[model samples]
Target: MKPGPVIRIDFRGGIVSPGDLYNILVAAGRLGLRRASFGLRQQMFLEVDDSIRNALCVELDALGIDYVNNLEGFPNIVSSFPAEEIFITRSWLSEGVYKDIFDAFDFRPRLKVNISDANQSFTPMLTGNINWVAAPGSPHYWHCFIRFPKTNIIYEAPVCAYTNDLASITACLEDQLMKGEMNGDALFGHPAMAHYLWKKAEAHLELPPFNLPYYEGLNRYGNKNWLGIYTREEWLSIDFLKSICRLCLETRIGQFCITPWKSIMIKSIEDADRPRWNALLDQFRINMRHAANELNFQVEDQNPDALALKIFLLKKLNRDDIRTFGICFGIKTRPRSEVFCNILIRRRAMIRLGRWSFWYRYDICCSEEFNPNKRTAWVFSRNNPRWLLPEQLRRAIIAYYDGKSIAASQQVEQSNRQPDKTAVQQIHQCGECLSVYDDPETSFGDLPAQYQCAVCDAPKDAFVPREWEKQSA
Candidate 1:
């Protein structure tokens, strides 16, 4: 929907082995798509126009890849494997558990499915239409939450399903929900129920508080180190990904886990291989450790303008040192997107009297109890101008804490404050990866006309003058 036909490649349970990923990348490179981005559902995607849509589809078809063209069809099956052995240390949930459930699926699911660890809040519990949350048990039990089709109503299953029955339960439930007017007691009456083993579910799951772990950078857990990579531009260079796949194969790493946050993580990383990863990141000019709050927001998938707005708001929040530790933000620029987050900043058409007279504003709302799993929404700010969003969101953050949010007075000053010249300096920045030329002795203009970015090989014109600007309005 965003200027080009989006090709989505589902990574079954957000798990892809190095060899399989490498092949896909090689094919994409042959098709002239040099960059790729992951989706919120832990799916890989690339933007292709009419010029090569047919060829790309053919290439994927030839490889027997599972994909959705033009963003239509059943969504990817996402799981919390990225958080296993890292964010969640004491959970019964493990990679093997997730893989077994994924492998048991005999048919393509009609509904979006999520297999998440209940102890870890990183992957979220209720994003999928049919969710199987890993609960505590010796053999492991899963709590099922079904969000009926075409409605926000989520019905928790009366009983906890056995681990072996997860796949069949989800598939059957998806089929039942698709028949329409099928919910509540009618669900338990399905003839398929006789084959599954289930126990009474807890009256309530006292889940962990919403605290997103700092997933970026090389983190140590057990004897292995894991690496999490995120890009503010929401796109990874094909070359960088290829390098990753090659490095993983050389290092004997099994697979790469894609997170619901639109990032990639490689687990079971050898300590000796840490230096190689460091070099890989350096070669790509990839920044590993962004501010924790910077990683908290989720922009609508494939929306560059929404990402730009998110960058602006994050800059303002960092400048003011606002505490957004437990909060997650979701920006919805398009209607009907089901992005899950604690605070949702939604773009709305304000006034459209005629073709020439159209205005747009934003509405900020917070989920009940600051939990994205709940659909209840409470308005924080409404009818705010585009430029005043930072100020509005600042108040919303205040509201998130202690429910004491100050009013964003419109009568307050509104102007583009000039950048701090002393604190910031102009420099040549690579457009591809945002890497700046920072040689003290030699200016960027002194470089040859044919000089490319040392990191990404972007052309000379691709290196634009980067300047800092103040928080406007």
Candidate 2:
């Protein structure tokens, strides 16, 4: 049978720990997963030294892993804006966002021109093959371009263009598609969309030029970021040497697809008694899907330029992790407005996969050092104390590890329990000599009392409270 669809994983945001890589490898072995892909983030800043690169080669060599030089999968190009503007968009925009609707249309077969100022009207550049998708919000401008083999550019000057509707947009696109000749060099928003359009041509679909399969496999199991996010989720466990194994025995589907941060396992693993590890895997999957869906939820083709702009804004805010742009260039340098058609056709290139793939090796070797905001120094700095950053997190960890609330002081605890003081009093007297105490009721040899220092085996009396300990009882 065919190897199924390609499986890709993002290493930067997902794989953060060594154990993460081990678990994924184990899972791959159990499932017979032979190929997968990994995405790298932060290409410009992270540099992989020879030693670290050698270490990576050794690890991949030992495990028999293959990789690709596909970057973070962001197509960083803008159709309507100047080349300089695209870079500005990147620097100002976060990872995954679009600048405007023109960007979305730029990826299409046509370029639209607006004539708000009569003095700055574009040289008419349209052919029977060219078309336009009128700007949805500001109809005063037309937003499409088409051309003939070698003729004066056909111009579709808008006289109060704002009233154009969907019918007009559809007509323009259809007119361009019908014409046997149009600019082939312009970039489109989604390659898939372009492919779909090309396929619309009965003959074009039948006589396609591409020969290779559309998808490629990527092996990304056993990545570090995956471990940081999920320590020992059983559904992710590897049981055998050639396949990925899962703890989801009850899953109706026998197989699953997992990325560094996301796991697409069989539906049956959702049972309540499936063990902590299995449940943990399910929870992780739940969170991953929720996050991806939320980010892409608002993305739509309508008013693409505005949508792209919103996306750009989100990326700048660090709200979205994957951004795409369509590249396009112009024939003439000046009369920026006049160059839309020629520019769209010549300067357009889609950057689906970018520097992320090339830099992944560096990312894996030292993610902590590369991610500035995540570096230990930044997190623990006086200005940004880790403990105080989020109050709920402090409480949650404490709740998980018994009632030892991180925010509560020992002295405060003693005073709060004055009403039911007997239990406190018993522990206080023994606190000094107790190397450790478990509930005094613990069976004699089940495990020694944890009341004393496990390392030095010293009596509790020898323990001096650190500043964080507050006043002694």
TM-score of predicted model 1?
0.82
Local accuracy of candidate 2 as per-residue lDDT tens digits, 1-473: 11123222223212122343445454443344433322111011111334344444444456644322222232211111111121122232121221232223323223222211111111111212333322323323434333332232333322212222322443354455445433433222323223222211111111111111111112122220011121111122232211223333323223232221112212223333335443454554523322221122111111223233334333432442322111111111111112221111111112226522111100001112222111111111111122232232222222323322333465576666544322212222222322223234442245334323221223445544322223332
Residues 1-473, candidate 1, lDDT per residue (tens digit)? 24467898999888999989998999999989899999898999888978988898998898889888866587888888888889887777777878888899877787889888877888878878898887665357887887766555677877888988888888778878888844756786688887899888767565666888998898889998999999888899999999999999999999999998899999999889999999999999998788899899887778886888889888899899999988899888765667778898877654446543247677777776677777534556666798999899988787777642322333243243443444445767676545556555557788768665433345789878877643432
Indicate the residue-level lDDT of 371 in model 1. 77
What's the TM-score of every candidate structure?
Answer: 0.82, 0.21
Give the range where candidate 1 is weakest over 10 consecutive residues by summed lDDT: 404-413
Q: CA lDDT, every prediction?
A: 0.80, 0.25
